[model samples]
Target: MKRREFFKKGTTAAVAAGVIPLVTASCVGAKDMVYDRKQDKWFDLGTGKTGSNSRKKTVAYDVAVIGGGAAGICAAVAAARNGSKTVLIQDRPVLGGNASSEMRVHLNGVNNIKGKAERETGIIEEILLHNRFENEQESFPVWDHVLYDFVVREPNLTLMLNTQAIEAVMDGDKIKSALCWQATTEILFTINAPVYIDCSGDGLLAATSGAEYRTGREGKAEFNEKFAPDEPDGWQMGATLLMSSKDMGKPMKYSPPSYAIKYTHEGGHKRRKFAGFHEGIWWIEVGSDDDIIADFEENRHKLMGYLHGVWDYIKNSGKFPEAENLALDWVGSLPGRRESRRFIGDYIVSEKDMTEHKHFDDAVAFGGWSLDEHNPGGIENISEPPSYFHYHFEEVYQFPFRSLYSKNVSNLMFAGRNVSQTHIALSSSRIMGTCALMGQAVGTAAAICNKKNVLPREVGQKYIKNLQEQMLRDDAFIPKRPANDPNDLARKASLIFGSTTSSGDAKKLINGFSRDIDGKNNHWQSDGLSADLQLEWESSISLSYVELKCDTNLQRNIMMRKDSRNDELYFNGIPNELLKSLSLEARVNGKWIKLGVIEENRTRLIKFKFDTIKTTAVRIKMTETYGAENVKLFEVRCYA
Candidate 1:
C-alpha cells in the first residue's frame, strides 16, 4: 500500500502490535503519522467491564523516550510535534526530574556569560515561557501539572506516568522493544519503536542493552581535564536532599527529629553562607565514593538526617535570629542525583571541549552553564565548598551529535545527564536547562532516524546537516552554525525590507542566527508596533507556510526560580518583546489577500499554515507587542 494510504485506511487493519512488521513506522518524525484516523475502529472486547483480563499491554510508536524529566519531556514533545508517534515514560508520578516538586532543584541554564545571559531557544525556551504564563506563582508542584499539560496537549504524543522502561528487548545491536513496567496499572507494557531515546539520568535501558558506559571520576590525563583527580576513582557527585522553610510571621519553637544528624558548623567552610536560608539549602547532600546508584537508599537516609541537622542549626543555634521563626514547609525525600553512568559515544566531550570552545561539524546543541563540579564528600565534608566553581564560559560551546549516541548500541541515543561526556564536561552540561536542549536535539534526530531508516550514528555521519537545518527551522539556536534550510522561500526573495529600519535590516532575517549574540544583532527591530515588513519575489512562487522567529530577550533568564527573581539577570514574567498581534497577507497578481492572523501569540517561533498560494510578494504587518514599544524579529521563513 502507498504510505499515504497506510494513514488513510487506518481502521481496516488490527493493531496486531509487536509482530506486524510496522509498515508505516519508517516515516521520519512528522506530526501526521498516527491519530484519530482509526478512533472509531476499536471493537469493545471487554467481557464484564472489570473482569480478569490480560494485564500485558502492547503499543507501538515511531520513537520511545525513556525518562520524563526536562530532557525527556523535550525529547518526546519534539518527536511528536515533528510528526513521529512518540511515547514518554517516567518512573515517577510527576515530571520535571530534579526540578519536579518532589525534588525542586531549579531548572538553570546558560544563566550568565560574562555578565549577560545567552539563554537557550527552542522547545526548552517554549517550556520556560509556558511556565511563566501558567506558573507565575513559581510553585514547584503546579509546575509539574503545567508540564503534564504541555506533553498531553501534543496530538502525536502519549505520556505514561509512573511507568519505568526497565529492560530492552534487543535484536542484534538495535533495541527492538522496551519492556516497561507501569507501577500504578500493574501492567507490563511492550513498547515497540524504531528509535529509542534514554534520557533517564541513570540510563537503565542503555545499560541493560549493553551500551558502553563509564562511571566514577576520570583521571586528568584521560580527557586532559585540568580539574580531575590525580587518578581515576569511584567518587561520583552526590545526590542532594533539599528543604524549604517559610517564615511563620512569629517566633516558632524548634525541635529535632530523632533521625536528625547534629550539625555544629564548627568546622564548616567559610563559603557555606546561608544566603537564602528561607528557601532551601543546596549543600545538604551526600555522595558515594563507590556504586553511587547502588547507594541511593543509604545516601537518602543520610541526606535526610543532614537536612534536619542543618535546619536544627538554623532554628535553634544562636548564631542567627532571622531563622528563629522559619519552619520547614517542604522537604524532598528523593535526592536529586548528579553523575551516574556516562554512556560512551563516538566522541566523548571533555572539559576542554567546553572551556576551550571546540567546534563540531556535527554539533546539535549548545551549553554555557559553569563547570560546577560539586565537592567530593558533599555536606559531610563541610570544610570544603559545596562545589568547586572550576571554570566559566564567555561564550556558548557546541555539543556534538557524535557525543549523544552510544558507541556500541546501534539504535540507542541519549540526552540529559546520561549522554556521553567526561565527568568534567558533565559538570556544565548536566544543568536541567542544558539537558533540555540536548533532549530536543536527540528527539528531533530520532524522528529523522525513523524517517531515514537509519541508526543515530548514521544520522550523525551522513545527515547531520539535515538535522541541524530542521532544528534551526524549529527555533533552536546553534551558535555560529547559521541555518541554511533549502526549503526556506524567504531566502530566495529578490527584495526584503522592513517598513522602518530601527536596529537591524530586514535582510538580516534570512541570515539564520535566531538570537543576537557576541555583540552582533541577527534581528530586525521596528521603531514601533504596527510596522510592516515585506518580501518580494521576481516571479510568482508557490508557498503555504510562513514562520517567524521573534525576540524574547534571550539575554535574560526566564526560568522559574525559588525566589521568583525578576531582576535584570532572571525574569519571572513573560517577555515584553514578543509580537503579540500579527497578520499575514500575500499579493496574488496585483491584489493582496489575507492569509491568517494570530492575536494571542505565545511562542517565539510564530507559524502560519494555509492553502498554497501563487504569489509574487508577501507582507507581514505587526500591530502590537506584549509590552515593548518596538517589535523585534530574528528570521522569517516560508515553505510549501
Candidate 2:
C-alpha cells in the first residue's frame, strides 16, 4: 500500500481498534526516519539567478516540542536532559515567547506570595540563574542571546527557528507527524515523534491534530469558579503592547501620531492609575471575545494607537509634571499575548483546585500566582479595573500530571497558557514561571513515555510515581510532596551530620523536603563559612555522582525585571547565599580522596560526577559563598 493510503486506512483502523498489526510505516516505525544535510540532495533549478530549491524533510525525535517560550524551552531542555532526543520548533528567530526581547515582558513566575516568593526551581530556576550570571547589565536584547545559548548548548535537542507547525498528520487520535513550514529556509518539515508537546500559547499543532480544546472564559457554573464570569462569554484576555521610556536629562516634547487616539482618562477607573509610566503601561491593551487569534493584527494596531494616546495624555495633560524629562525609548510593535486555546486533558485545573489547595495524587508541579483576571475589554472599558486581582494565594498549590496531557489525543501534551485549565485557573497559572514548572513536568514525563514506549495517559496512570521521582531527582520542587527516591544513597546513609550548625538539624537534609516551609527547617545551615557535611554508609556502596541543592534564597525572586527592582521581596543581583566554592571527597580505602571540586558554581543544584568508586563515606567541604557569612544546603543526594 502507498504510504499515505496505509497511514490513512490501515494505521487509523489499527489505532482505533486498539491493535497494532499494520505495516512498519506506523508510529513505532517512524523512528527509522532521519533528516541530515548529507543524505537528501537538492537538485539545482534554473528558475532564478540563485537556485530556488524547495523540498520536504522528515526528521524524527523522541519528543517534538512546539514553541520556544519559557515553558517550551524548559520542556525541551528537561526532555533532552532526561535522555530523550528532543526537537524544539520556534516560529520566531529567538526563543522566550512573551519574555523575549521582542516583547520585553518580565519573565515573572511566583514573584510574590504572602510577602515572600515561592520561586520555581528545577530547569526554570537554572534558566533564571543563567541570565543573572550572564546578563548582569539586564539588557533585554542580550537576554535573547542568553536564551539562545541555553537552548543550543543542549546536545540532545535540535532547535528550528522561523518554523511554524501548521498541520498535523494524524494516525487515529495520535499525532503521527507535524508538518512545519520554515519561512526563512522555504523548506517544509515533517517532525515525527512518540510524544508531541504544544507549549506554544496558541497551541496550533494540538488544534490541528484534533486535540480537544476550549477557548475564552469559563462561567462560574462550569467549575464552581468563584472568580470566573457569572455567565460564560467569548471574551479571552487581551494582549498588551509594551513601551519603555528613558529620562533624557532635559525636558522632552511629545506629539501624538495620526493613528493615536485621543486619551482623556476622563471617566477611567480609579484602579487604572499609571504609577510606573516610565516603564511600560500594562493597561494599554485590547481583547476579542470571538476568535481572538483572528483579531491579533486588528488589536495590535489599536494597542499601538492606545499606547501613544496614553503617552500623549501623560506628557501633555496637566495631570502632573513627572513626565518632563521622559522620552519614549523603546516601543514594541508586537503585543504580548496572555490568553488563547486551552487544550482538554484528563483533569481540567479549576479555580478551587488552586484556591482550595486541592492536592492531586499525580501532582508534579506547583503554582502560586494570584488570580489576576484581566477585564473583558482592556483599556477600551475604562470603568473597570485593568485587572480584577481576584484572589491571592498564601502557599503554593500542586498541579496534577493528568492536566498536562491531552484527553483525546493519546500522545499529545501541552504546557504554558495552553494547558488544560479553566479561564479562572489560567488567570494565575498562566504566569511564565508556573507554566515552566508544568513544562518540566511534561518534558520529564515525555522522556518517561518514550522509555516505556507508552502513551502519555499510561505514564500518568501507572508510572506517575516514576515520573514524579525523576523530576524530584532533577531538583523540581513539588508542593506537599517530598523526594523519596529509593535510589538516593543519602537517604539510606547510616549517619549524616554537619561540622557546624547555626540552626536546623543536619538530618533534615535527608528528610526529602528541599525547601524550608511551614516554619519548619529543611536545610542544614552552617554557623560560619568553611563547613564540612559528611554522610557515611554502614557498608561500602558504589557511587559516581553527588548532587546537592544549595541555598539560593527562594524567598527572593531573581528574574530580570525592566526596573531591576531590588527590595525585600526581589533581588536584583545574584543571591548572596549561593555556594561559590565547593569540593567533594570520597572515603576510599579508609583515607579521604578528593573526587571533584567546583571553584565557581552558578547553579543551585551542584553536581559531582566521576568514575564509579566503592566508598563508605562522602564528605562535602563548602569553603565560601557569594556573600553570606554562612553556607546552607537543603538536600544531598548520591547516585551510582
Candidate 3:
C-alpha cells in the first residue's frame, strides 16, 4: 500500500481507539540506508512527488515540538514528563543546535549574574549533569550522542531526526498538523498534535501557520526601549560559522583550498579578533544585510567564505608567531544563526523590561546575559567592535509567560531566539540557558493545555499560576516567583529541624519559595551531614508524593567551558552539597513506615512517588552528602 494510505488507515484506527499510532522502526527500512525508488516502494515513502515518490506518513501526539535545539529538547522532555505525549522534530541528524558538533558553538547559560553563579536548574541542568557523568572526555561528538540518549530515555517522547518541517496545516488559528520531510527515509511525516511549540530558531512553523511576527529591530518609541534604533529597521544580527584549532607537537603547514579567499591584517578591519585558539572563533559572521530566512543559502556561502578568510589570515599572516604550531582541527559547515523571525505574543519583552529588571507576575524564566548586540556591518565592516555591550543589569531579569505563546495562533507557542521579544531585548534573552527555561515553561504549559483542552493564551490567563507551581515542583526556578501550592500538605503542618540552624527560620521549608529569589530567605540549613527534618499534623493526611529540594551549589559553574583546566573539571562533577543518600518515612498508626529510600541521588530536586497512604507525620533522613559535611535544603512538600 502507499505510505499515505497506510498512514490514513493507521490514523483512523488510532483516533477511533483513542490512542496514538507510532511508526515503528521495524516496519520501515534501516534508518541509515537510503531508499531506492523502484526496489523499495515501502521504504521510499516519497515526499508528494509523481511516479516514484508520492507518499507520506501521519502520526499523532499531544504536543509537537519543532526543532531539536536545547530549547526544543527541554520543551519536549518537559511536556512528556508532565503526562503529555510529545514529539520532537529536528532537520539535522543530531540535536543541540549551535552546541552540537555540527555547529561547535559552546553551550552557555546563566553562568553568572553580578559575580554570583546562578546556573539554570531543571531539565537543562539535568542534561548538563548527565553530560558530566557520560561525556567525561568532553568531546563534541560524544556530547551529541549524550543528548540523544537523554531524550530517547523518555518513553513518552518520540524524536524525529533528519526531518525538516516544510508545512504547517492550520484550522483557524490552531496548528492542526505539521508536515515534515525526511530525505534519507523519503518519508513525509504529518504530525497531528493539540499544542505545537516552534523551537526551530527561525520560527518556521509559526510563520507558516500565520502566527503574527516581526523580523527586525523595533523603534525606541515602540516599547520605550533605550537600546532600540531611533527608527524601526530590517537590520538584524548576522549569522556566524565557528571554527576551532589545536596545538600540534610540531609546526604545521597550511594550504588554502582553491576557492579560499586570501587574507591579510588589512582584511581584519581591526575589529575581528583572533585569540584563545582552543575556543572556537565566533566572529566569522555575515548575512544581516539580506533576508535572513529567504536568502539562507546565499548567506551560508558568505559566512563560509568569511570563515576561510579569517583562518587564512591567522595561518599565513606573520602577525602572530604564537599560532605557528596551531593547526585547524574543525570548521563548522553550518552557521550558528543569531536572529530571525520573532513571533508576536501577548506581551513583547523590550529593552526597558531588561534594563529596569521588571518582575512580571507571570514570569516563567530569567536571563542574566549582558545586552551584547553584534554590529550590522558583520565581517564586511572592520572599523567598530564586533558587538556592542550596551547595557548590563544589576541582576538577572525575568521573562514572563506572555512572551512564549503566539498571540494569533491559539495552539502555537515558541521558544529559543524566536520568542516574542524586541530585537534589543532578544540580545540578552537569546542565550541558550534562557532559551532552555523558556522551553521548559512552554512545554509544561503545553501539557496543561492538552489536559484542559484549552489554547496557549488561555493557559497564560487562567492557569498561569498552576503552570508556575508545576515548574517549581519539577525543580525549575523562576526568578522572584515563589511556589505556593495549596495541595501541599506540608504547607499546613508544623515543621521541625533536628540539627544546627542557619540564620533563616525552619518555616521557610513550607513558605513556597524553593530557590533563592529576590533576596528572600526561604531555605533551611543543618550544621552536620546527617540531619532529620520532619513535618507533623494533628490528623492523618493521605499523600502519594514527596518532593525535597536540596542545595546544589549554584555559585559555581557546572557547565563545560572550552578553555577549562584539568583542575577545574570538578566543577562539572557532582555538587558537594547534594544529598547522595536519603530515606523518607511516615508514622502510620503511631509506627514509622518506610515510604521511600534513595541511593546515589545526583539531582538537586528529588521526588518520591508511591502508592497513596495515610500518615500523621513524615520525616526525611539524610545520611550522606555528595561531599559537603553539612546538609542544607531549600524546601520539602507532600502532595495529596
Candidate 4:
C-alpha cells in the first residue's frame, strides 16, 4: 500500500479503537488514549501534535497571560511583582507582538505635545530610558529585547515561548485550564490559573474560550460616536509589512510578484512616486482589508516586491538626485496588524467619550490622539470630510478601569489595542504610549485581584483608586489629579527644577534654570532680591541659602523655581553652590519664626501659614555661610 493510504487507514482504525498509533521506521506502535477527566471527553481530532497518547504534568498558577506583546509583558510583570505565580505564554520566540524587532515599527503616541514627551511613563518610560542609554538614537529591536527581558527576569513570572494555547478547559462560564502545544517537544502542557488575561491583540484566547467579542465598525447610534458610520460597516483598519532602505550607488532592477499586483492604481487613482518603492524609510506600508489571515502569505510576497521596487525606483529614477547611493537596509519579518478581534469588556469606551472628554469615576488611563482611521485597502484613505479628524478637547480623555475587564468572562482581563472600545475610540487609544499605560493599569489591577482573592469585577472602586494612585506614583499618567501631598509638591518642584539635586540643597545648580522649565508658555526671568531689606534673614548664615518668599498670602497654590526648566541657580553669571549647603528657613515676623531649614537634598518650599502670615510677606534667605555677588530669585508666589 502507499504511505498515505496505509497511514490514513491505520490512523482511522486506531482512533476508532480509542488509541493512537505512533509510526516508526521499523513498525507502528499503538497506545491507549486517556480522556481528560476535567474536560469529560476524548481529545478532539485536528488538535496540535502532542506525542502518542501520553498525558503531561500540569502546573497551577495564580494568573495566566496569553500573548507576549507590550500588554502581556506588563501584565505578567505586574502580576508577578504583586506576588502572583504567573505564567506568560507566547507563540512567538520574541516578546513584542507588533512593535517587535522583527516588525521594526516606530513606537508612536502623543509624545510630541508642545515639543515635550507627554503622558509617556511606566514601563514604556523605562524602555525609552534604556534605549537612551544603549543608543543615542532608539532602535526597535533593543526596545523589544528590553520588554522580553523584563518579563523573563521577573521572579514570579514563568515565560513559555514557542508555545501556543490550543485548547481551553472551561467550567460553566469560567476558564479552568488551558492546553498549550510545544512544537519542538511535540508535547501538550496544561496550565491552570485562577485568573486569565487576554493580551493577545487577535483575541485568540477569548475567541477559543467562547468569549463574546466584536469586529469592524459599529453603527453611530449604538454608542452615539459621531465619527462612526451611520450604518454598521464591515470596514477595519488594514495591516502592513514595513521595509527600510539606505542610499546605494546605482539603481537595482526589481519586479513585484503576480499576487502582489492583484489590485493596482485604477479609476484615475494616481499612484504616489514612491508607492511601489522601498527606498524611503517612511514609505513602507502594504496589505489589504480582504482577510488578514487568508491574504497574509500573498501580502508578504507583495511587500517584498514593493520594497525592492521602491529601491529600484529611487536609484534608477530621476526623482531623487541626491540618493545615488541608497540601498535596502532592513525589512520587517512579520506584518504589523492594525485591527483584529476586540474582546467585549465591562464597558466599551466610545468616540463620544473622547469627544466630550468624558470623565469616568474609575479612570485609569488617558489618550489624546485624534481618530486616525486608516483606509480599508491598507493605504490611507482620504475623504471629503476626511476619515480622520481631531476632537474639540485639548486635554487627554480618560479610559475607565472597568473597560479593561471582560464582561462575559468573570476572571479575565484584557489590555492593548484589543481592549474594549469601538473602532473610532480605538483609533485614538491604539497608540503605543496609551497601550503601555493601559498595560500598566491592567497589571496593577491583576495584582490587586490576586492579592485580594476576588474576581476582577469585585476588585471594587477603592482598589481601582489605589491602583490609579500607584500608577501615578510610578509616573504613569491617569486622568484624575494626583493627590495633594508634601511628596507630590516636592516632585512638582523637582520637575520645575529639571536637574538633579542632592539632599536639601539645590547645590551644583546650573545657570539659566529658567530655560529648562517646561510647561511654561511665556518666557519669564527671575529678579533675585528681597522686596525690603528689613524682611531678610537677620544672620549671614540665613542669607547663604536662597528662598522663595510670598506676599499678600494668596489663596492659590504656588510653584516657585530658580528657573523654569532645570535646577540650575546662578548669581552674577557664576554657578551658585551655596543653594545646596544651607537649609530652608521660614518665619512669620517675630512669632516664633517657624525657622525650618531647607531639607538637605530636595527643593525648598514653605507652605504659607495663613493663620499668622495673613497679609504678611514671607522671606526665603540663604544661610550666612554662603555669600553671593548677586542672587536672583526665579519665581516667588503664595497660594491658598
Considering every candidate listed, which one attains the maximal lDDT? 2
- Clashes per candidate (backbone, < 3 Å): 6, 0, 0, 50
RMSD in order of candidates: 9.6, 6.6, 7.8, 12.9
lDDT of 4 by residue, 1-640 (tens): 4322322353232222221222111124222122232433455478854344555658899888888876777777777876788899888888878767777555555533333334354566455434433443345566666666667777888988887775556788788887776566655678898888888787656655666666678998999877788987656666666665564657543444343333232231232334434423332444343334445677676665555554554555566655555555776657777776677877899988887888887888777766776645543331221134445345568888888888877888888888999988888888766777787777778778878877888774557666765565444556544432222222222223212222212211212121122332211222332211113223222112232411111111111111212221111111231232333233444443443444332122222232323212233443321233223332332232
TM-score of each: 0.92, 0.92, 0.89, 0.66
Candidate achieving higher TM-score, 2 or 4: 2
lDDT per residue, candidate 1, 588-626, as tens digits? 989999999999888999999999999999999999998
Indicate the worst ten consecutive residues by lDDT in candidate 3.
13-22
Residue pair clashes in candidate 2: none
Candidate numbers sorted by lDDT from highest down:
2, 1, 3, 4
Which sections of candidate 4 miss by over 4 Å? 1-57, 114-116, 137-139, 249-291, 301-318, 321-323, 380-393, 460-462, 484-640
- Candidate 3 colliding pairs: none
Model 2, residue 120: distance off in Å is 0.8
Candidate 2 deviant stretches above 4 angstroms: 1-52
Q: Report the C-alpha lDDT of model 3 over 1-640, residue by residue, as the tens digit.
A: 4322322453232222221112222234445232224544444345554445544678999999999999999999999999999999999999999888998776777666766667789999889878877887788899999999999999999999998776677798788988787867878678999999999998666776777777778888889887788998778898888888889978888877766655564745454567674465666677564356656677788777777776777777877788788888887888889998788899999888888888898999998888989988777666667888898666888899999998888899999999999999888888888899999999999999988989889898899999999998888888767788889888889556655674566678877777675567778888776788888898888989999888887767667666653342227566777888999999999999998999888688889998999998888988999788888888888888
The lDDT of each candidate is: 0.87, 0.88, 0.81, 0.56
Predictions ranked by TM-score, top down?
Answer: 2, 1, 3, 4
Candidate 4: C-alpha lDDT: 0.56
Lowest lDDT 10-residue stretch of candidate 1: 14-23
